[model samples]
Target: MRLQMHAVKFTADQSLLDFIQAKLDKLDTFHDRIISGEVFLRLEGADSNKVKEKIVEVRLMLPGKELFVKEHDKSFESATDRVMDVLKDKLVRFKQKRNDISSPAIAEAKTRVDEEDEVYEADEL
Candidate 1:
């Protein structure tokens, strides 16, 4: 998956970026059709009680739908891990639904429709 990363208020180092990339790359095993994704790493404003709380937002582009997850923690790694867990469950469910739609019954129904269309075209000719 192609991923674009954005750092909101601070610069992210190479090791941190590498960590995130490794985590996201593992997601390919769950769903190979993932087209691309975006990750936003932000430090929450100082106005809040917690100083510089880490926030991670991820958006994944799939075949026909998009998955997004936002998480906050004291560290970027933990937040990213939480986001990955959520995305994994969602991808599994999506794959199951896609499989269900392509079952033999649906395929047979689609075949019938195609045959009817052919017959109608012949009559018109």
Candidate 2:
């Protein structure tokens, strides 16, 4: 899986970049076919609260669909963690739905083949 991270406005330091990369690398374990992803980190001004908050947006590309999750918090790490958690849930659902959609067709095909085999054997007997 390939990850491309963009920090808006300010340049991100090495440690922050490394941390983000490490966090993103683990996403592949959830779904290995993830083609690529984009992470957007934006610094937001304090609203009502005195502390500045960070906004992180994660977009992942799957085989047939795209999954997106965004989070807002005081720390980038926390925001990223939240976003990844949401994305993981979505990914799991996607996988299950995909399997569910294809499994019935597979079972139907197998039944048809078995029926054909039974008919052939009966005719031979």
Off by over 4 Å in 1: 47-52, 101-125
Q: What is the lDDT for 120 in model 1?
A: 50
Work out the TM-score per prediction.
0.79, 0.78
Estimate, for each residue in 17-124, the C-alpha lDDT of model 1 and write its tens digit.
999999999999999999999999988874565666899999999989999999999999999999999999999998998888678988999999998876456668
> What global local distance difference test value does model 2 have?
0.85
* Candidate 2: 10-residue stretch with minimal lDDT: 43-52
Q: Kindly report which residue pairs in candidate 1 clash with one another.
A: none
Candidate 2 per-residue lDDT, tens place, 9-93, comes to: 7788879878888988888787878999998988887444454899999899999899988999989989988988898889888
